[model samples]
Target: MPFRKFLGWFKGFFGKKKIIRLGLYGPPNAGKTTLANKISMDWTGEPVGKVSEVPHETREVQKKEKVTVKVGGKTIVMNLLDMPGISTKIDFEEFLQYGFSAEDAKQRAKEATKGVIEAIKWLENVDTALVIMDSTRDPYTQVNITIIGNLEARNIPIIIVANKIDLPESNTKWIEEAFPQHPVINVSGLTGSNVNDLYSAIAKYSK
Candidate 1:
């Protein structure tokens, strides 16, 4: 090989890598923020966002930058993006069941609608995606399918997270069976169960 060509190859091989933009995506109440918090807390000693039982509590995309994760001798630097939960519909009446006043529910519903659009827009900017699913719930849903389809269409590396495995009703197998084409890791974001498995997967699969 020519000396110039070899020198170029050497620099390229040892060059600084671009930071990955890792987006966490799922339907409402699927524990996206909880998992983001867990990952952030583990690597950066900080939480990404507040988690709430109320659907659409996270009405905007939350970002934690420069989180360095080291697992199994591999290190990856990423900008963790905790996205707003996606949904087919956001009705103010639903919040009433959670004791939200009519006016506040309406306002929340409006903000949530905007959030979903924002998340979809951010899809184009994502380098890798974690499509989180609630293992206790049925894996076959329009929201889940749409999320996966969008990521696949964008040719983004996908890592499915079967979250909430600490719950007795969780069936991680269902998620694996539903999307055999992608990698799945079962973990409990709330309790940190099997989170190491998730970290290893991230190191292996992230772009």
Candidate 2:
């Protein structure tokens, strides 16, 4: 390789690319934490937050710092912010199905509402956002549209993750049609399918 090209590549490898806060935002049970865990584990040998079947399992914004990701021979440093699920309404009755007492459920509901606010406030600090959507669910919901609109209005770099592609009913194409202007990577966070594609997209577009 030529010396100049080598130097450029070396700079890309070692030179300071300002670290970015890459946030994950989506509705409840859309695999935000699952994807965060996958990426964090791959790079840092750790998971950012626990995953649960119950909705609003992650009732807080969880952050993992200094995670370095390499894609297509280029590396980028990021602080992964796994934001809590965004919902317009939170009712304690929803938690009853999870076997929580009425009091416990109410408390959880309160925290979850707070989490939604924190997630939105954290958006001001995020340089890029991964709008995660469940591929198996309809992508035209108010929550999904609202999040994307907020990010677009701010001109934030956005990548739509059509997660859970491993499921039989997962339809990534629907997401493409929903938001034709943005790039979407289809993957299964639970099974690790096509996650490398997501990494490459992050490297290519998030910069």
lDDT of 2 by residue, 1-207 (tens): 979447656776996466778999999999999999999999999999999998999999999999999889988899999999999999999999999999999999999999999998887778889999999999999999999999999888899999999899999999999999999999989999999999998888774
Please give the range of 10 consecutive residues that has the lowest summed lDDT in model 1.
4-13
Candidate 2: pairs in clash: none
Q: Enumerate residue pairs that collide in model 1.
A: none
Off by over 4 Å in 1: 1-12
Per-residue error at 37 for model 1, in Å? 0.3
**Candidate that would win on TM-score:** 1
For each candidate, the alpha-carbon lDDT, in order, equals: 0.93, 0.92
What RMSD value applies to candidate 1?
A: 3.9
lDDT (Cα, tens digit) per residue for candidate 1, span 1-207: 979447646765898655789999999999999999999999999999999999999999999999999899988889999999999999899999999999999999999999999999998889889999999999899999998998999889999999999999999999999999999999999999999999898888876
> What TM-score quantifies how close candidate 2 is to the native fold?
0.92
For residue 190, what is the lDDT in candidate 2?
Answer: 94
